[model samples]
Target: MPPIAILVALADPTRCRLIELLQGGPQPVHVLAAAFRISRPAISRHLRVLKQSGLISEKKFGRENRYALHPGKLAPVQRWLAGLLPAARITEAPAVVIPAVEQPLPKARRIPKPAATPVILVPALAAEAAAPAPAKPAVSQMGFDF
Candidate 1:
């Protein structure tokens, strides 16, 4: 199959999971659908896409159809990825440098003296004038204060 179609087939989450499931071996449509919460038709649709892309192949068995992964069809993709593997497998760690920074806080300014205000001494008021009266006691009969 074309590389683009293969990639498109694997792009979907459902199809990717289906591929993972198929890796164990071939599976019938109902068996694959049982693995997902979605309707059986939805699973079939994903399988159809995978089969059309040549990422998978379907076989006839009595009355049922079984789908299996076609790993051979992924040769181009595997080779392309193999080419990138050399760069991905690092032998030496890359260097990292952090530059030093010097920050100076602003100096405090001298505050000017304020003009003085005159002060007079007075005796504090008696407690009764400053304190509020206590609330009246609540009485309940059917008449109640909350």
Candidate 2:
């Protein structure tokens, strides 16, 4: 899977929260949503994105779906990060930082700040003013709201 897709899925705060919950252990959709501040459907949408990204896997038990981390897909990401860090001490003796004359010190990588990105803020009253009256979905559904 493309890294961008995984990044996009987690770009949403709700999806990030859902992933955080699953990090502890597998959880039912209702249980996951309880930790979120959004509506049930909104959480469902976040879960959908997560499922598509291969970050999470869902198992159906009767009417409910239980989601868990997909470690197989996650291992590569972890390995990639581990590759960036300094290697472990070669011997039991206290490790010495012997600078190689051939290779200069590795430059620190600069990470962009998340806060530098633009954010869209919606005030309660302004949001309410922009809200459209409820339009029922075309199909009836039974789902849990935690």
Candidate 3:
């Protein structure tokens, strides 16, 4: 499995940026801390996490502690990711085309529809139809009927 510690160490934006800084070559803690707006102690804490993950190494030069990147430690992570992808085939199979055979569709039989009958209205029903309809209730934008 890919090193969970490496993933956890790189989870923080501060730690990721520290890795980027170390990529330039070994640098003293003071120089690395100067690259960020955070406190020196906070930078030291991030470096410690990276060291614990085996992603970086520290060397003492006089009173200063210089950190360097161990990029080879990331191979397990790369291998784990590559394993998730499907393998490519060296040779592809040739395509074969089959000729199409078309057949005529059968004719559909039609049935005649019955004619519509006329409607006659009585005088009382005619008067009611001539009368105006009642006004609908007012509706608000919220769908409430007033």
Candidate 4:
């Protein structure tokens, strides 16, 4: 798979969420859309991106299309990240052993003193209301008074 294409596809939040959902099994666009607030068309667009990136596989099931994760495409990404791990790197020499020092650690001043925060207490509202319930909208007496 094209690593850059896969990275670009997975970079989107919705695409990543869709990829997570696909892990359980293949799902049609409608089913995927139900898991999110976005419209079906938007979900389809995301699927297309994943497909173009070779990160997902799509199959036509009946009249609907089902999408599944193409995990192999992510192998490159995994390998790239794995290479960054210290343990994964090869060394010409054996592991070094450093002696432990008995020196006391420097004191930690973790929390700074609380600065004075100004408190503005709002005064209580007046008991009297602004006005009555809009004067009952001035009902028309054209027909008849109740």
Q: Per-candidate TM vs. native?
A: 0.55, 0.50, 0.57, 0.56
**lDDT of candidates 1 onward, in order:** 0.77, 0.70, 0.79, 0.76
- Candidates 1 and 2: which is better by lDDT? 1
lDDT of 4 by residue, 5-39 (tens): 77888888889888878877798888888877668
In model 4, residue pairs whose N, Cα or C atoms come closer than 3 Å (at least 3 residues apart or on different chains), thus clashing, are none
Tens digit per residue, CA lDDT, model 3, 1-146: 66788888888988888887776789999888877777998999899999999999999998988999897897776666667654832332333323223455568889888899887889889988888999999657563234
Candidate 2 has an lDDT of 0.70
- Which prediction has more favorable TM-score, 2 or 3? 3
Summarize candidate 1's per-residue lDDT along 1-146 as a digit string, tens digits: 33677887888888888887887788899988877777998999899999999989999999999998887787777666657685664342333322223356578999989999885544475545667988999666563224
Candidate with best lDDT: 3
Q: Which stretches of candidate 4 lie over 4 Å from their true place?
A: 86-146
Residue ranges of candidate 2 with Cα displaced over 4 Å: 79-146
Best model per TM-score: 3
* Cα shift from native, residue 7, model 2 (Å): 1.7
User: How many pairs collide in each candidate, listed in order?
Assistant: 0, 0, 0, 0
Kindly provide the TM-score of model 3 when superposed on the true structure, using C-alpha atoms.
Answer: 0.57
Cα shift from native, residue 84, model 4 (Å):
3.2
Candidate 2, residue 1: CA error in Å?
10
Q: After superposition, how far is residue 122 of candidate 1 from its true place, in Å?
A: 77
| C-alpha RMSD for every candidate | 26.9, 18.4, 25.8, 20.7
Tell me how far the alpha carbon of residue 127 in candidate 3 is from the true structure, in angstroms, after superposition.
82
